[model samples]
Target chain A: MNILMAVLLLGGLALAAGIVLAVASRVFHVEGDPMMERIDAVLPQTQCGQCGYPGCKPYATAVASGEADVNKCVPGGERAMLAIADLMGVPPKEVEEEAAPPMLAYIREDECIGCTLCIKACPVDAIIGAPKQYHTVVESHCTGCTLCVEPCPVDCIDMLSKPEVLEEWTWSAPGKASLVKLEGDSDARVA
Target chain B: MPGLLERLGGLFGGGVDLRSLISPGGFPGGVHPAQMKITAASPIVQSPLPPQLILPLKQHIGQICIPIVEVGDHVLRGQKVARSQGYVSAPVHAPTSGTVLAIEEHAVPHPSGMGRQCMIIEPDGLDEADQSMPSLCDYLDEDPAIIRERIRLSGIVGLGGAVFPTFIKMLRDQRHPIETVILNGVECEPFLTCDHRVMLEHGDSVVRGLNVIMHAVAAKGGIIAIEDNKPDAVDAMREAIARAGFEANIEVRVLPTRYPQGGEKQLIQAVTGRQVPAGKLPLHIGVICQNVGTAKAIHDAVCMGKPLTERVVTISGDAVPHPANICARIGTPMPFLLAQCGLRDLSGVRLIHGGPMMGERLPRMNVPMVKSTNGILAMRAESLYSENAQEEPCIRCGHCVEVCPVGLVPNELAWHCRNDQFDRGQEYDLFDCIECGCCSYVCPSHIPLVHYFRYAKGQVAHIEKERAFAELSKARSEARDNRLAREQAERAARRSKVRKSGAAEAAADASDDTEAGTSGAESGEKAS
Candidate 1:
């Protein structure tokens, strides 16, 4: 009789807790892709589509659902991958490729065939051209995605490394990398 | 060198710690490195023009000037070759009569060692002057706007190593009233005595320029602040102030010797006892500071009808045989000046443009000196501190925090910067750092703290620029998509309207034919 009373009391308490949880979930039901939005915010927003998805948003959605790895953005490189890894609380995978220098798309105006195909391929709308007219790339806005380079029939587009201006120059990190050293062969690490 | 008591006597010839009487609540944190002023007593010598002068258009920190004179055009001495593009920029002038050789990319005196577009000129050696703007000897009665315009046209910049355009600082504004104009004669950088020599030699010109500057800004009081290390300069400047007959409004005050005491903010705090708020200019705190060299340049511009084509440069270092203060023309090559100072070997010598503390280490000797080049240090590799030791990890010793003049936590900022955690760095007021290298000088671990801070600042700026471009690209792509969608919708609407009208016409035709057929059938039946 005592065991029966204890079972009944425990069952009633469990039922009350379950009911509160159900009601709280119903009241605080959230819609839409909050996780996807957060992942997208961490992206570089180059929209190069190198990650097998359509754009940064679609790639972010796939990552949010665990369908895609975050290490595929070439334009964003390791910086974006590490940012996503930190946000998602996952162990970061080592980036296989070396980090490339920043680049900008340049157009050879003389070689351009006035096809306007490359202009349509640009995701940033950085190219300015009309049909049967010479096209030029707005160097500042071009993300150097190489998308425009592939679509050009005449192959007028070139991805060139951007030069470091005086205003953009920064001092190098300390330690063995510094150029102002005496012995010059101090590359041995302590660890 | 003078004894302690003699130096302590200062401008009064008999006083102790006079700085307290002048400034109350002096600045908080500072470091005292050795003052290696070996060439302070050397007289100024005028240097001849080099064979060629490479004039970079953007010497000051603003928009690069646009070439007003074409290539191969002969320009007179002190004539404008490049015009100022914006209000914050200063123009480039011909240091001597010369013909433009080429406007092409060449290495400049910058830390990056990158090439910039510089106008090369082959001097004719005639040194003919361009007497276009007449001298305003009686500048006190002249309109302030005219004086300000003359300063702008003369291509004057801050000679205190900042190289900011001077005309912009003299703009009269009523909102932030400038009460005191301080002529900064504090040559506190180690091994740099260009300002010291200028104060001792051209005190009258400095005072006269101060009077003109005060008149332009409408400031009531003018104070020329000097360090106690240079007692002779103090006496010279004081004598000049009395001779000018403006002793009531203008005075000379001596300060204690300390590293970075000549910084624009530090000098203001030492003279006015008011801290310039973080991220604000000295002008915001009702004070305007000008370098002594800049004051003399202003005097030459207004009273003598001259443009800033030359300045005194101190050539001193261990590698140099004769260290002297030479008044060199702008655009003179570094090699030429070093040769003038008896420098024979340059295989292992580190050529630094400015003082040892904050100068840029030049990689090559192809670059030419600009308006802001005050000292050319050619030290042996053994003299540099970084050369002798390797940087170790920070032990959290808290020495950097103790010496930071701006009161920033260098160790924490450096840690955040090393990890690329710039958001955390901003939370610690990273932008308020003046980059004075005090913390780096005092760190026991030999950590390059200033270099890390510079890297972090550059990264922050680059990130901001990238974010701006991303925003712009997003906006552009969205607009394009909306435009395409709108055009497609308009075409669909037109096509549907046309189809509906065509269908209605067909139905009307069918009804008319049926009516006609029924009428004919009735007629036929009646006839039968």
Candidate 2:
């Protein structure tokens, strides 16, 4: 009889603790992880689909869900890959492919047929044109994605390397050996 | 009614002792190196114009000017060769009558040692002046807006090495009315005595310029703050004030010599005893400070109708046998000035564009001296102390923290910067660092603490720019997608509505055909 009483009391205590836990979980339910958004924040948002995904957001979601590899973003290159890997707490892997140097798409406006295909092809709306109107790329917003280059039927679009302006120039990282080759006689210490 | 008591007590006068005013009430941290006022006693000498003058379009801190004169065009002295692009920009004037040689890239005096667009001119023998700039001789009675316009048109910028356009600083803020205008004669930087000579030679003009600035800002009181190390400058300035018969409104106050006491914020604190809040201007605290050199420039612009074509520069160092303060024209090459100061051999000397403390190392002697170039220092190899020493580890001695005028922890900031943790450096108030070099001077470890801070600041600014671009692109892409989706939805809705109307019309026709067939069948049955 004593054994039966002890067993009943212990079972009753366990049942009560389970009920409290269930109610507490419902009462304090959080909106849960925003891991995909965090991953998207690290992305360069080029939306070029070089990663085999439709856009940066879809790729971020795939990486967050472990459905995609982190090294597939070509435009983001190694920097974005490392950042994503760090966010996911995984070892960084080598990029699957190399990317071209930074470039911006320029349209030969005179040769453009004004079909507006490149405008529709640009994911960032960097190109602005209407049907039967010449299109020009707004260079500031152009992510150097090269998405609008292939859609031009007349072969008017050319991907040109971004020009260096004095305002955008910056000092390189301190103590890092710079690989900038000197041109002409522009030696720093002429004296 | 200005008095020593009123000047020491600041805008709000109180029965305060001058001793307490000089103590814990002034600017926070500072260091006193050797007061190398070696050329203070030398009279100003005029420098001959070089054969070619290279004027950089972007000498000031604001917008770069656009060249208005084309190559091969003749430009007269003080001619506006480059027009100011924006309200904050200063126009570049021809230092002397010359023909434009080329508009091409040339090396500029920057820490990066990079090339920028410069307008090269070959000066003719005649120094013909452009007298179009109107002189507001009665500037004291003129409207402040008109005076500001004259200042802008004359292309006058801060001659204190800041090179900020003076007109922008004079723009009045209705919320914080300026009370006191402090004339900063504190040439605290070692080896720089251009301001010292400017005060000694042109003290009356400086006083007159202070009056014009006072009129421009509509401030009642003006105090000329000079370092105590230059007693002659103070006496000269006082005599100038008395000669102008403005002694009742202007006072000359002597401050204890300290490095960077001439910094705009530090001078404000030292003179006014008010700490300008972080990320705020001295104007916010009802005070505006102008360098005494800038004041004299303003006087020249307003009274003499002169654009800023030349300035006083000090040429000093061990490399030169005779170090003298020379009145040099803008766009004069460094080598020419150094040669003028008896520096012929450039074999073993390092040339600095400004003072040794805050100046940058010139990559080449071909770079021209801009309007703000105050001192050209050619220190020999022995004078460069601890610059090439291998950086040692921080001992946490906190000496850098003790000397930082902004009171930022330089050691930790340097550590974060060295470790590539810029955000951590920013959390320790990295932007507050004025790049004063005080921390580097005091560092026992020989760490270039200021270099790290500058590198981190540049990196942080670049990263911020990239992040901003990314955000802009992301927003644009998202907006484009939403626009396309909305257009598609509207197109589909319109097509669906048309299809629905066609289906209704077909249904109506089918009903009519059925009714006719039923009527025909009924007639056939009746006939049968």
Candidate 3:
């Protein structure tokens, strides 16, 4: 009889604790936003549609809604893709092979004819010049969209590859065979 | 006192501070090296200006300042000679009154030995200071935001090696609460003692600067971390803190003398016992670290309304006749500095900037002293230019692992870096390696582990850039394909519509002809 009473009391206390926990959870639970602003913030503000979406915000929204993969943004590359993947609780996918060589806008100054057509075509306003004057490219602001190239009548605009500098150079990773060689050598008999 | 409770308490405490043992302050790891700070005992001396100053526009780590004065334009000391191009960049002021000789590209002090855009100033030796002075005291009563803007307008940056803009760091979000402001006084680099002398001479200003920084960030408290090796500096800072009546909020912490202990992450760890996570900043861990020299600069900018025109630099190493710290004006050439110290025989002397460890070897002495240059070292050729033997394979003795302050696997990272396998290196947390040279210092094989890591990081970044371009092209091609398919479908639909209209016209004509035929037959029947 005593054992039965003790078991009943313990069970009642457990149920009470659970009910309290549930009520506390309801009171202190976080309200998640339907839109993912954090993912959007991680994206480069280029809005170039290189991510298979019309704009960066749309791609961010798609990722948040699980309608699009996180690795679709090629301009943002692996870092952005990984960050988005981590935020959305998904594994980072291998970047596509075609997404190589970040392009830069180059102006053929001779053929420009001082016309500001490319300036209006640029979405980021990377091209700078007054009307009927030679225009220049602000390399930092240029998103390499190639939109400006299409509008130039003289075909003066071209996409150039960014030059590699010592500052930007990184070392390649050592091969797996080297590690195996190290392991094998260590296991070999000493002379 | 001899009760059971007392005995139990005694057993637990043992009259010792438990905090001192077992990962005290949670500092990850560090290295020990020769301190070589005996050259700073003498007072600071000034060096005569070079005949010509090659002042690079891109000295700091941001947009290059554009030169406002052209060739033949006369300038005075402390004058706004060059303007800041963007918000993230700092302005270049006239180090001394001089005539603008030229604005062209020249050889810059860099590891790559490349040229940068620079302004060549020819000093007239008139030593006339800029006459304009704006009252800074009036802004003391004004809004703090306005004061910060004033500081930014003055073009002040961190005088430390990392020349980050000071105002950007001060403008913090109130949501991310800052708990402690750490003033780094531990100049851990060997053969450099400029910061140590600054602290000894200007301890009051350093403390006041700490107060200003704390006020800017709304931090609860501040701590000045000095190495125990510099007892005199520590004592001076402690006295200054006491005199300011901030002994409680502002405390002095004496850290173990270690190489790269002055690094932002390592210093934060030593003071607060907090470990900044991999790929995160000290701000993320509720801490902000600034150099001692930067603190003094901040104090000057706030009180005197002066921009960063001059800084203290250490001129030392074995080759110099007189090794001393000099308060050098910006754009002062290294040759002039070496001449002041009486340059030793070049037959066996090798000159370097900063320190032997982590400092770049100078290609020529013509490179001007920039904001990041802390020391100008001239060592014996035998010591500085010793031929290193070929690197042998790692013995797996774990010396590099043991010395790594960030707890990263350097051996594995270096292996991956050497073989061009960047993905594997990233998996081993290659980004976390601070390039402190601890791994190389402790390695028995004398492998350049830091070099390997730097190379790996560059490769990974390049690959990332390439990948971004590929993705962009793929999207463009896909869009083009979609557009072409839609256009083809529309053209086929238009052809079908035209054919249907033509057929309907023909049928209508045939119906009219049939009506005519019926009229003709009726007329014929009437005639019969």
- Model number with the top DockQ: 2
TM-score of 3: 0.68
Expressed as tens digits, the lDDT of each residue in B321-409 for candidate 3 is 88889988877877678777877334445567787667766545456888888898877665652223446789977778767888787
**10 residues in a row with least lDDT, candidate 1 chain B:** B15-24
Which regions of candidate 2 are displaced past 4 Å? A1-34, A69-101, A108-117, A128-135, A152-156, A178-191, B1-23, B344-349, B380-387, B490-528
Q: Which run of 10 residues does model 1 chain A get worst, by summed lDDT?
A: A182-191
* Model 1 alpha-carbon drift over 4 Å, by segment: A1-34, A96-99, A176-191, B1-24, B491-528
Residue B214 of candidate 3: its Cα lDDT? 84
Cα deviation at B166, candidate 2, in Å, is 1.1
What's the lDDT for residue B402 in model 1? 63
lDDT of 2 by residue, B33-94 (tens): 98777899999999987888889998898899999999999999988999988778999899
- Per-residue lDDT tens digits for candidate 2, residues A1-191, read 99999999999999999999999989988773488888888788888888998888889889999999989899777778888999999999999889887789999999998998899889998898898999999988888887787878999999899987667666565456643332212432322
For A171-191, candidate 3 gives per-residue lDDT tens digits of 333222211111111222111
**Tens-digit lDDT track of model 1 for A85-171:** 887789888666654677888889999989998988888789999988999989888876777889889888888998778777766
**Residue A128 lDDT in candidate 3:** 87
